[model samples]
Target: MQTFDQVIQSNIALIQKVVDFDAKNDQLLPLDFTAANTELTDEILDDTDLFSDWVNEKLAKNNASYGIGGYNEHRTIYSRSTHFDTEEEPRRLHLGIDIWGPAGTPIYNFYDATVQSFAFNDNLGDYGATIILTYDIDGFKFNALYGHLSLASLNGLEEGKFIPAATKIAELGAKEENGSWPPHLHFQLIKDMGGLKGDYPGVCKFSEREKYLANCPDPDLILKVTFS
Candidate 1:
């Protein structure tokens, strides 16, 4: 059996349909949650509204449609309560690629898949409205997680139903509905969900980077936005 990463890389055309990647009109933005920026300090990162405004301004300035990045990123923004564990090392390494865009922006299925599960994880600084889709390519089975979506996105969705490739599945959620963070889609591919439903860890501890990254490979194999 081909490895999950190999499966995606070998068939980039099928996986590339998850988002509209127009190199000409669509500009890719890389977000920095670390303290490298003199202006974006820890206090500002803690404030979602301010951070969202800052991000939006940059998008506007660049005339970009999305603010992307976060795969394997050592982010400081996880200092928020919901992302950190008191008894263990903080989960700072992000395992997903975040596409920042306006609320209600439509998200499409890259391939024919079923709605494995969906839920509203209303935690502070967490994936609020989430969806997990299962895919079977050849004999390899993998999953994808769409996080920070509108609560209503889960309405009427059932497991074992087919969602065609490029089908408009859900819209991005507003900050009020998306766990009080800036509107964005947290897209993650999982080799195995480890028997979980409706959610999976998008962030992991820096110490266990090797294991987490192996399970969650670079999403760009599918996203194909190396431009970010």
Candidate 2:
């Protein structure tokens, strides 16, 4: 069987760029989450609300619609826990691409799929409202995890539900509902769920990078967004 990366690469063109992101024209702004980005702003990163405000400001000032990129990025923000194991290496390697935009932004499925499962993680620094969509392409089954969506996104969602390609499955959640962070969509491609549900590790320990990367490949293969 081909790896998820192999399959995605072979089907690259078929995978649509879900978010309105184009780094070439500055439609997207790359964020350096390793620090508070205090080089340009004096805002503090410890405060999730204020930090999110700053993120939105960057997009607005740059005239960009979204803040994109961060696959396999070693982010310091994961220290918040709901997604990390602080007791260990602090899992700072971000495994997905985040599309930071206004709350209520629509989230779509890249390919036709079924709702394998969904839930509200809700823990601080967690996925908050989450959804997992499963796909079976030629017997190669995989899933996509969408995190930090509006609580209402789950209103009528049901297990085994069929969602057509590019269907608006959920809406971006505000900090109040999206795990207390700025409004954004955490989109991750998973070859294996690790027996997880609604939530999976969006970040991993440095030592486990190889294993995790093998299972959680780059989401951009589907989003097709150009990163700066």
Best by lDDT: 1
RMSD list, candidates in order = 1.6, 2.5
Where model 2 places Cα greater than 4 Å from the true spot, the runs are 20-26, 35-43, 80-83
Estimate the lDDT of model 1.
Answer: 0.83
Candidate 2 lDDT over residue span 1-228, tens digit each: 887767777776666445554456748778877755434233445577777778878889999888885898877666654457767567888899998999988887788899989999878888889999998766679999999999999989898999888788888998888888889999998988978877788888899999999998788877766464
Cα-lDDT of candidate 2: 0.81
- Candidate 1 Cα RMSD after full superposition onto the native fold (Å): 1.6
Give the winner by TM-score. Answer: 1
lDDT of 1 by residue, 1-228 (tens): 677767766877676366666878789888776646567776767888897898899899999889996688888777755656647677888999999998888888988899999988888888999999999887788889999999888888998878988898888998877877889999998888899998899888889999988888787777876554
Check candidate 1 and list the clashing pairs: none
